[model samples]
Target: MPKRLRLTRRFPVAMTNDAYRRLQSFAREAELTQDEALTFLFEHFNSVTNHENLTARLRLFRAELEARKA
Candidate 1:
């Protein structure tokens, strides 16, 4: 049986529309609610993420963030 999860934190999140759409898609594909999908992702972050790819993407996003805010 799968372990049950209790939501212990709630906070506001802000993301680009593209990112939000991707999150919705992932949640639908996984048959989980958006919150649950986020929880699962964060919980298994290390195992599911590609470290090199994430590092490169983070750099790109950070570089663009300032421009996006304008």
Candidate 2:
């Protein structure tokens, strides 16, 4: 078995009460520590943002092709 390397860093952030509550609820539901919950959220956000960027680029390319054909 291969050993895994761990690199941990800390980031301090301040949020509104509402945001804190939402994060707390998510952490409880997912059975994750606050740090883990935040990591999950960051990863999910990156995926969604990447998908949106790709979709926007595809739309622009299709529009350009249609304009050139006309």
Candidate 3:
């Protein structure tokens, strides 16, 4: 069987050393790339939380930060 192609984009993020290490461990255990691990986490979190509200709040917070920087 042929492998399916997946389109992806680069998304750089900052994290604490401990968090980074934990994510690395998770990826290794799941046999996935860090990106895949992050995607899994995000989807799980969304399912457990109010995803739309969280996304709106995050967008607003980012906009405020950018406005302050400007």
Note each model's CA RMSD in angstroms.
1.3, 11.1, 5.7
Each prediction's TM-score versus the true structure: 0.89, 0.55, 0.52
Sorting all predicted structures by TM-score, with the top scorer first, yields: 1, 2, 3
lDDT of 3 by residue, 20-70 (tens): 999999999999998888877775885756878988988997889867567
What 10-residue stretch in candidate 1 is worst by lDDT? 1-10
Q: Of the candidates shown, which would achieve the greatest lDDT relative to the real structure?
A: 1
Evaluated against the true structure, the overall lDDT of model 3 is 0.81
lDDT of 2 at 64: 94
lDDT, candidate 1, 1-70, per-residue tens: 9887999899999998999999999999999999999999999999999999999999998999899999
- Rank candidates, lDDT, best first: 1, 3, 2
For lDDT, candidate 1 versus 2, the one ahead is 1
lDDT of 2 by residue, 1-70 (tens): 8645342778789885887999999899999888888877775876646787878987997889767567
Candidate 2 pairs with clashing backbones: none
Least accurate 10 contiguous residues by lDDT in model 2: 2-11
Q: Where in model 3 is the C-alpha error above 4 Å?
A: 1-7, 47-70
Clash total of candidate 1: 0
Compared with the true structure, all predictions reach lDDT values of 0.97, 0.79, 0.81
Off by over 4 Å in 2: 1-7, 48-70
